[model samples]
Target: MGWGWLSYSYWFPRVHSQNVPNSALFYPAVDTDVTPCHYRIPAVYSFGSYLFAFCEQRLDTSKDYGRMNIGLRKLCLKDLGRCEDDSEWSKFCQLPLLEGYRTMNPCPVGCKETGKLYVFVSAINAKIHEAEILKGRNTEDFKLFVTSTIDCGESWTPWQDITYNFNENVPVGSKFVVLGPGHGIELHSGRLVVPGYFYRMPSSFTEEILRQMPNGRKSPPYNNVGCSFCLISDDKGETWNISTTSDNFTYCVVDNMYRHMGECTIAETVPGKLLLNSREYGNGQYRILAESEDGGTSWKQGKVCTQLRDPTNRGCKGGLAKLVLEDVRYLIASNCGHPSARKNLTLWISQDDGATWSKPWTVRDRELCGYSDIDTYMDPSTGTAYVAVLYETGVSSYSERIDFISIKFSEVLEKCSY
Candidate 1:
């Protein structure tokens, strides 16, 4: 595992060893402005002739708890798979939220077949923090809301609360669910798959057990039992269902290494097959990988991808995109490459679905890097396909700003020497 990159390069040599610059690098796509806040958790998707980008506009503070809203910008596609300057994306607007609730985790999915775009977010009570809910000290009033657009970000439908329908099918002990902090996918079969995970209350802890337990055990130990599942919609984004697969479920152990899996993203490898990449709630430094055989309804056991290294203690959220060129499919991922620090942002290419990966190509070598989302698009005129990345990065703090970058598929293959 330690020499995974070296072994991959040995098998596939590059014809051109020189560095080929990226197509475009748009810095500060979302930045802290007048009020002094933050823009984090970037999600990008190619819809229509524009690139739809979204992120969390954390007002007052960058902390997870507080006033937050989803901000979006539609970038115009230009020649060679590049987009117009960030300044030209003047349609920057913030979505409306329910009173006393903060909307977050902007997971956008677009259906080319229907020409509809949906953004799914979690509306949480502003007074409650995630820690309080995880520790069982406060029950979070979490609701699911989704809004759609048909005119390419010109206007959006009113927020429709779908909490009841989604909750009714969730597991009995489910605490709450978190949507993709990135983007979702519309499968070839017209299935809308949104990757997410939720925490569940441990059934072993009862009143009798609490009474006999010690002081440390008497207090609600953080409910670390979690399962990664997909929010599936068979008829476009009209209705949804939850997957009850047990393979990706995990409970906290004595070492606290196998905690909850959350902030997941999904990509369809082939027809009816999907790959899920998730962030860990514990100290595991490797990203958890799982596969679904039946279009994200059920998943195989979640295992650590030794090649995909992440920082310990709540692994950072990464992005995954599926690309095909010359009838060959490749899975591209982006995240902070350093094992201990949120720096060294890099891109990895997986030739065999996800079984093996090529050596990483450094994106940002020495700066704070955070959550990222990846999607591929083609130039409307030239038909040149490209891989786009929207990620959080800063010199001092990872959440200080969000940046966007794009590179041609041919150049990516050359740069990574895959």
Candidate 2:
């Protein structure tokens, strides 16, 4: 891609050129003090027709280098769309962010079958890295916290630990897949899909470091990676089959040009096909994409759609929002912000299930980007799309807050112009 902007490559499908700038950008607003760069975001539909934003609030004191926490918020759709003159266009009410986050991860999805929004967040009480500098902390506290809402976002219940055994393992990608919501929907034959993964800590740091991480050392043979397996459930996420390794896929590539497969989100397209989006950090760059037609148990491969490239902006977590606007099935992915320059947020589309894609547009182009995760819902009856993005505003991870890019898919792809 060229600097500032590059003309749509010939490799791109031929389509009319249009500029759609969302209204939400007009008066971007901030809600809380991130303290030390907070941006891994995920959002789902609100009962009130609004959007709920999620992210981790990291607080690292000079003396305490590895300390971190996560939080959530409730925001209106038009707020991120920047559609109105009302001050609420970008306002957020911080919910009781999880306490003692230390090392907590959160992701959410709405299940139309159950009519309740559920979240599969990573919960850890303590994490101890073998590096002499990384000991004494609680290195054994990570569980998935599932919360939900029935009456819009008017209220929320305490987190319910869906994890079967603290030691057995957990199945989580960047976030869990939503077969439906509330209890989740079952197939006609009485089958259901709930995707998650478990991580294996290192046996010892890999030299230079006290104990090598199981996957690899902190620095790596420069390359240390492994895959988490999925734990399936047929009874609406109540009971799960044994965890299984995703056999169809492999770890990310590490060329002199690329680094690793960062964090990610998964989606089910068509009937059995699944798509994965990830955040990679290394070589001072970021890229994302993973696809599987076998129900996320494994995949076909990874596609580095250049259009999804955000040079300097560090992308975080993101989701898939499907739409058949003008006879095309589009999946818009976001990285909150790329580590590269002028490139922050993006919305990409894939016509062939999740196999291939067309050029995507940039949205929520904020400079300070962190864990950028998104989830969208379409009024099945109206085809009105509502997308929510989690992003930071300041200049770096040190300055952050939880804000969303709330807008209708039509308003974004058809009406708004950048």
Candidate 3:
């Protein structure tokens, strides 16, 4: 139990079935502890049978860094384990410019022939670690905000400033960064790979994503730590351009070795053979997949899943949510554990699609501190499997708060297909 203890109480992680084949967990009498679905960078989407937990209701301390205040909650997919009656749950603070501050990191997807649910969030205002160090200093005034929800979570419609010009005349780069996995695939020519991500901020980075330098800080750090593009929204997510990757990876620092591409998520395997699976935090750690047949623009240089472990030994900037159940392939990621240990919060699975990965269990072990997140979904008509995690037990010095867990993959595959 290395750096364990998620504090508070109610814990769950019991899925070994018989001999542990599809091994899964969380059944502490049906999981459920403390929760508003917590947030330290959260985003979960399960649509339909219901499993949507968006975060960052983190009011302000200048913003993002001030942390916690962006809100939206809805749970009822088997109550995710235990505890219920939060007086009949109902939350909504649909980004009123994140009043009081702290936006979030959401990427909801569900377009099954237009069941309608397209959420791609990243609406910021500063403070979240200085909005990634002011997009590495100046990303055209660093202010990110993108919102949409065509009905599935009830209602939410304002805010959608993606700008998305992409011709590069003066686009300053930075948007989406990556929000894959929601199924659109028609491509053989129909065109529809809205996999999102194009970061490289600091042309004055703020003023709510200022269009073209309302005060884009006057442009400075060319590529401090950016570069991740690919946007082709031909009428699904409603329009986007720059289908980059001919040579568009504009931010890299070799020899001394530095890389870019944060918050990625893609999983489509048969149409044009797409597999992107991403999550790499600069300098180097692991969890790369990269393989865009003709869809993600271009990418084919990452095949390391090292059983998933990178608790910040100088690396840990989390984001990775995948799903594929039945054919297997599941992933809900978090960093700061292996050595960097943000107090244990890792989860993994892959019947094969990330090539090779296994043995990364534990929703949030529980010892004494807190900070947790995760999300998963697989329901191509009813294979039924949805996981949503949120744990934050007592802040540093010992005491904060947030806990809510849910897991159901046929009840851990009927107790591990044993």
Candidate 4:
């Protein structure tokens, strides 16, 4: 695989687990047949009594080697077992969600106040080939776009490109921008927020450095550093504002290359405060943390989170969800517990906002586990609550299949040693 992309055989068996007693059900949301290359970056949200899952459907097209498009599959709360039928699930749109562009990172959010669902995606114009990018050819920068639905996942509005809105707020030289690739949150006050990052390209390009570059370089063409921020909407999904970027924070470097903070997750830890958990791309061993006092408008400098570890400096993406159980607010996070390997997918509970976390409960111990998203729902009939996790897993590699696991609140409280 080029550019360190993981490659898995097409014949890998679909692995599903229901061994956990509290897990109501576990199954593979997508297999190799649905996407020949792989189904990557899963995002899920609950709308009414149904759960919707979205992923980047990777396939080879005539123009691009493995072009990606957003694909969706849904499950009914009343009958999780029936999702196995091919006809039960359907795409959010008939054609590619963002046609003609290389789409990635599907971040979906639902607003109870408005009864609408929104999906945010990042795309780069794939005009240049991979070989060209490796050879220091400058490709077009990324653009942010969004789509919304009023009636669950039945239909969606056309893609609304919001690149201009983002570019207007970012610094003049900012080159690329991307969103949560997982799920966003609607604060109790009705404000919506989606965590994201932007890469600031070098101010000036030197011909000498460009000419001296070696072949097969994995980094982008320009010497860029990523900074985390958030996209906030005060008037629902009609408009958005880019929060202050976290560029003042001290970034770590390894091998003379700057490590950038990227792909963050945000949760309203308190009434007016937000906690941003970021992936450290540098020598830092723990996830980066930043605080916002006024909703998502501005952010403080990021610091290393001593408790959360990211081994080998290759930080993995994590999921954060807010749960209120028995009148106590809790924050639950899911990530690979190990620093270096994407194994031991564990869930941690935080009772005092995010100041501290309890011991984690291992969701998947040994197999390959990677990017994950968490969403919660309360059954109206029984008043019982459930948390659904959609993640990447496989027997040999994490890209083999996307899986789902539903666990009850009672099980978490009993298992989590708070």
Of candidates 3 and 1, the better by TM-score: 1
lDDT of 1: 0.74
lDDT per residue, candidate 4, 219-300, as tens digits? 4334565678888888987888785553322233334444567878888987778888888765556777778888887777
Best candidate, lDDT: 1
Order of candidates by TM-score, top first?
A: 1, 4, 2, 3
Tens digits of lDDT, candidate 2, 64-99: 225554344555543444333324532433434456
Across 261-283, the per-residue lDDT of candidate 3 in tens digits comes to 44454555545656654455553
lDDT at 37 for candidate 2? Answer: 38
lDDT scores of the candidates, listed in order:
0.74, 0.45, 0.46, 0.68
Q: Cα deviation in Å at residue 242, candidate 4?
A: 1.0
Give the TM-score comparing model 3 with the true structure, all chains together. 0.28
lDDT of 1 by residue, 81-147 (tens): 5543455564457876668888999999888888999999987888878777666555547878899
Ranking the candidates on lDDT from highest down gives 1, 4, 3, 2
Error of 3 at 400 (Å): 23
Give TM-scores for every candidate, taking all chains together and pairing residue i with residue i: 0.85, 0.65, 0.28, 0.80
> Where does candidate 4 have its weakest 10-residue lDDT segment?
8-17
